[model samples]
Target: MKNIWKILMTITVVAGAALILSTAAFAASDSKTLTINATISARAELVLAPTTINFADNSPTTVSSVSADNPVAVTARVRTGKATAATLTVASANDLTSGSDTIPISAVSWTASGAPFIAGTLNKASAQSGATFGNGSGTYNGTYSFFLANNWTYNTGSYSATVTYTLTAP
Candidate 1:
């Protein structure tokens, strides 16, 4: 009977110690929860007004008269947003076509009032090497003058070319 009591007491003590250790290990840790967020902004944009330019016919009695008053003016309004720098470029080949016949782009030239460059000849290539309009923000109203000096005789018909103006924000 004495041996039985001693064995029971030892088993009870071991069980109690294991239970206490398990409870302490589980209670030592903690947990929490949170949230995250994000957003997107607007990009750079440009707008041009008076997209059309029309030059009236000038009757030249002499080559001097044609050369004297060959220049015509056109105004353009540029409105831009969210930009660092912008450039005004034109097509290199400013050609006027009728059926199978055509006139060369170099016959006409252009000059801008507030442009940061000297007057440049129009062409039919690409629109990269034109002129620097300016930098920063807001709207800019600029006038561009086109001139065609009558050094040679052109076939008598309608002579016109569509000029494309591109405002690139870089």
Candidate 2:
């Protein structure tokens, strides 16, 4: 009887210890919170196909205006506020020049084929708007056909000029 009682007591103690350990193991828990953040800012991109354009000589009487690389493909991408406006502009470095002879930059004008794009003449003193967008975060595609007014007064020589295109998202 004493031996049996000892064994039972030992088993009860072991089982109680195991039950307490298992309960502690099951009840133990730890956790930490995590925070995430994301940010988007204003951005702009402009692309032009055939960065260089050439004008072929023609009779001033027969042709009132000369075409130079018609239908220049243009792409604009922008990211801005929903109510903010995105703008694209072009500025001429200088008038078409061959030595001392020159043609006014204003003589060069373009016709646009796209919404929000407007027809405008090249300007050396000021930037000309190529396109304007009321909505934000979009890709706009368009074409610009350039024309130079042909005049008998122009000095005949290879003439060239540089123009810059700017896209702004604000």
Measured by lDDT, the strongest candidate is 2
Number of clashes recorded per candidate: 6, 0
Clashes of 2: 0
Please provide TM-scores, in order, for all candidate models, with all chains considered together: 0.53, 0.78
**Residue 154, candidate 1: C-alpha displacement in angstroms:** 1.0
Give per-residue lDDT, candidate 2, residue 130: 92
User: What overall lDDT goes with each candidate model?
Assistant: 0.57, 0.90
Clashing pairs in 1: 92-123, 92-124, 93-123, 93-124, 93-125, 94-123
Q: Least accurate stretch of 10 residues (summed lDDT) in model 1?
A: 64-73
lDDT by residue for model 2 over 23-43, one digit each (tens)? 988866888999999999999
Task: Give the Cα RMSD of candidate 1.
Answer: 9.6
For residue 111, give model 2's deviation from the true position in Å. Answer: 0.5
